[model samples]
Target: MDSLFDVLETNNKAMMSIAITRKGQPLYSRAIGYSWYGPVKTQANTKTKYRIGSISKVFTAVMIFQLIEEGKLQLTTPLSKYYPTVPNAARITIAQMLNHSSGIHSFTADSGYTSWLTQKVTPATLLSKMMPAEFEPGTQHKYSNSNFVLLGYIIEKLEKKPYAATLKNRITGKIGLKDTYYGGKIVAANNEAYSYNWQGNWAPDTETDMSIPGGAGALVSTPADLDKFMEALFAGKLVSRASLTQMKTVEKGFGMNLFVFPFKGHTAYGHDGGIDGFRSQAAYFPADSIAIAYTANGVNTNLNNILIGVLSIVFNTPYTVPDFKTTLYKTEELDKYLGVYASTQIPLKITITKKDVVLVAQATGQSAFDLDAVAKHQFKFDPAGIEMVFDPINSQMTLKQAGREFLFTKEK
Candidate 1:
């Protein structure tokens, strides 16, 4: 139990909150780190709210199923019934959108997405920006943000109200989730956590407009509220048992806004989400009658590793606390790894740079990330499970990841 706290302190997340329950009884609940960074920092607590990101998809799915239960919607309904001009509208069904098999282009992955992601967007404007479908409807599985966005729009249309209002009346209000709601600008007074990208110091991350994520990634919630929601959802307080079964039915590795996570021969159904610097996970294991939720405002370590640690704690399994201390490297020593390195094995190039005595690595068409040095000429990016060993004398580097190695030579 102490080891779990040790892991949180060592990982140094800006804010980390976890809540776990079994048989409808809470087993553990904890929160650590600061909700706000810098001189005017505010410590996080069990009640602090964090943007849950794509976990909102799960909530959106719940609302859709509720509508179906009320005879207001049908899973087999075609998209043309709502928006005929949408690509593949004639062929795509509501179920395809729910399971992310709609073949619609993911607007979040579009080339210009980042350019305007921070700005507010109207529904029509956002839909107009969506690219044509990439594949025939239901022919293949493809996770797309556009699908959830469209679903959100449908929820709004059918409810004759805004998405946030529908969520309040149909879900959160019914669950009595005091700490969950639609997010807006971070207001320190309300205990909303500010997301950050961690390096040697916390760097404030850019805020994505809530309107852009909409039902895809806009909801804010605490771990406790998330756990409660999962419990009620599985207990049939939200949707009918038959409808819940459909949401859990897997097709091409995806269910209706739910995904299965295997742990020690047991499967948990839930979703993971990331938006800016916030990372979230919520899952419920019906066999064990357990529900767990974790939310973080900032992370430098791998998120999966964190989730594994929380699960291990809940299950009373053996787990080791990570050693967060880093070996300091001189500025001159870090400069040696600075260069553009390319690998013949893959059509990608990595440019390493020295930033304030720390090594940073950036790949082609990707954002730069700080690489922590473990030893002389050896640096690692833990988030991606990647390690790089630089041989400055030969102007070459070897990258090791998941038991595979790639060799790169510095270009002249």
Candidate 2:
């Protein structure tokens, strides 16, 4: 597993924790980097808790299923029963919400979400942001945070308690999870790790109000605790076998709050999560009785590469850790790309800027992201597989990714 360790060592993550278990036994477990980035950086241990982001939805799905098992909820129940104002509430079913087929407009996808992320959002304000359904209910599959948020509200109403309490009593508490709970403001004394985005230096990211992501992405946990939770959940300790199978069943490429992940000669059920600077992925392969969980506080490297490395090690497949070290460009080299580029075919515009010495890119409606220099005049955003090559002579830029290329003329 030295290759797995090498990947962590080479990446610019502030902290990462990973655990792999087979048949209830740990095959590999490790934590690397610091809990935070600073001269006073606290080394991350296996117990350090990072926000698990949307992984909380899996636990939320379990609660909904538990309610279903008790005859308190029905998969076919319409949203009108609880939330009348929601668009198409009379037609959208609980199962539609569970599988992201409800067509409810995701509030996070709105252009103005970043402006309100830091402020506390009341339930009424949150509802107001729902806008309208994107399409006819149950017609097509489109993932939306609004669906999970509504499910959480339903859980709260039915349980006669807050969503956090329901989560604790119904899932975490039942699974004996010691380090999993709803997160709030970052409390350093509590050993909660704040997330960061890496460029040349680790830049701290803003924390979203927990209320904004509640029941959808508010839970904080260590990888070990998450691995334990998934094991118990799949072993029929959290939900019934019937409900578990339903959660695993996919429709239009989406299951009930779960996604299908196929690995070497085996299929696994899992979810990937991202909120703020933290990202996570966890999966369980029943065929092999193996479970793997990874959490990161800062990610400058592509997460897929890390997961592929870990899984390859678990399956005894040959894998190589990537060499991430790259050549540094001087200030003069960066200044040449600092300008606005516009494409006639697309309404979006790309603006590149240099902060100190780090190159950053911002498009219409999106926040700026640091772009790493992969080669002279060629920079890339690894997370999105976006590569930008600049032609100073023609004053043009070529953007390539996903087997397509677009050319943009540099604007004076």
Query: Which has the greatest TM-score?
Result: 1
- Candidate 2 lDDT by residue in tens digits, 67-157: 9999999999999999999999999999999999998999999988989898999988988888777999988999999889899999999
lDDT of each: 0.89, 0.86
TM per candidate comes to 0.95, 0.91
Stretches off by above 4 angstroms in model 1 are 10-14
Clash pairs for candidate 2: none
lDDT of 1 by residue, 285-394 (tens): 99999999989988777778778877877777888877655679878878778999999999999999987778999999998888888877888888788899999999
Top-lDDT structure, candidate number: 1
- At residue 249, give the lDDT of candidate 2: 96
What is the number of backbone collisions in each predicted candidate, taken in the order shown? 0, 0
